[model samples]
Target: MTLDPLAALAGLGFGLSLIVAIGAQNAFVLRQGLLRRHVLAVVVVCAASDAVLILLGIAGAGVVFAAIPWLTTAVRIAGAAFLLGYAVLAARRAVRPRALEAGDPQASPGLAATVLACLALTWLNPHVYLDTVVLLGSVANTHGDSRWLFGAGAAVGSVLWFTALGYGARLLQPVFARPAAWRILDAVIAVVMAGIAVSLLLGL
Candidate 1:
């Protein structure tokens, strides 16, 4: 069967939008990227982890959302709340930008420790599941038979994003050292999250 371009595009757009945010997982990836410590391994783990979770959401989580319509509404409402709260944090960070603490590459932990920390940050966090399994899953299911295509798009996005972030972080070091850079980034995040939250609530 031919894949629906619209469905795939929708998935890619939504997946990138959802994943490109200030979160524990992204922060870890950013830090690892900056340090240049196990960059390939870290990137692979994150992208692979996201692919697995996306499958769970697209294949199974959507089923749960289907069985309970009320839960879907609740999850949407909760997602809105999550987005708004994320916006608040981003706004606060923009007001008080943090200093770059990438530290010495020589002092970075061993590969095992680094991988374990990355795993902990990604899997142990509840927010990951919310974003991927619940929110993305529900939205993908709405696409009907094209949902897997949507999921595939999302997986592709995850791979692309992690690869870019991991590989491109070195280029950002000089600029990111300035607090002003973080302030601008946080401000953009705030606006994006707030707009998304407001739109989600309006849809409900």
Candidate 2:
């Protein structure tokens, strides 16, 4: 089947719209980018994971998920719990904010730990599956024969977003250099995380 450029662009726009929100995943990526700690690994993991999930969604995983309603319920419960826990941690960070320094030995986590954390942040959240696999996939399928092209576009959007977020954050280094900035950032992240968790619990 021939690829449709317009369908691809539509997919790209839709994908970006979904991912450009402020959430735990984006918050973590921004923090890592600011700290310049395992930025490449984090970006790669997030982007690659999103690509896989989006493709799965396009391939009709959404139908599979729908068939097993109990699975989504279980995932929602676990995801809500995890988000709330992370929210508390973010709140703690806000209470004791730290500056983002380039070479702070104490501030930097090991590469393996950072990558694992990134993966957890990406995969453990049920919203990721809903957005990428279900919503995006459903959207792509609407394009008929161009669905794969649409999926490819969405994957490209994920890659572009992660790359920009992971690298573009450095431009804000001067702003994040202060402890107060970190405090504000963490506070925002905490609120966002908590809000999402609450929404999940309420089935929103």
Candidate 3:
């Protein structure tokens, strides 16, 4: 299992491409980042989850996943339900938008609750398995003995993305301070969550 720079670089690019989408997980991270509450915990949970999934894929768990289609179906249904619930919450927030108040203790959830939400967003999403475990695994294994190196690179990409999304979101604080801005953001989140949930259900 020799370390290969080319394989690692390819894995990095592939990993970034897959995760750079506007998904439920990204949305949650961005929101937490903007709120500046439990950002580090959320980032850690998301990045660590991605790393584990990528490594699992490289370790040939993708084969097991593929062999058991029913498992993914069950996950998909559960994810869709979770997404729908989040969508409703987002829609409710959109209906009653509030400006960002950094000093407001009630504005953000507690750390434990935040961590739980982050875990749910990361793990309950069935697409995560397809992207990280199945697809990334297939691609990394093609690197032969350098597959572990590729997995490492992909894991790094995940960490980088979540860190950026979670910490860098503070940069948008000025804009999001406006209640209208939050209204728009929540509206968008509602749509994205509902759309993804519907797609998941349809696929199942």
The residue-by-residue lDDT of candidate 3 on 1-204, one tens digit each, is 466788888888999999999999999999889888999899889989999999899999989978999999999999999999999988887775343354456556899998988898888898999999999999999999999889888989999999999999999999987878877888898999999999999997
**Strongest candidate by lDDT:** 3
Candidate scoring better on TM-score of 2 and 3: 3
For candidate 2, the TM-score is 0.91
Candidate closer to the true structure by lDDT (higher is better), 1 or 2: 2
- Model 1 ranges off by over 4 Å: 1-3, 62-106, 175-204
Ranking by lDDT: 3, 2, 1
**TM-score of every candidate:** 0.66, 0.91, 0.95
Candidate 2, residue 197: Cα displacement in angstroms equals 1.7
Evaluation by lDDT, superior candidate among 2 and 3: 3
Model 1 deviation from native, Cα RMSD in Å = 6.7
Candidate 2, which ten residues in sequence have the lowest lDDT sum?
Answer: 97-106
Q: In candidate 3, what residue range of length 10 has the lowest lDDT sum?
A: 97-106
Between candidates 1 and 3, name the one with more favorable lDDT: 3
- The TM-score between candidate 3 and the true structure equals 0.95
Which lDDT value does model 1 have at 24? 55
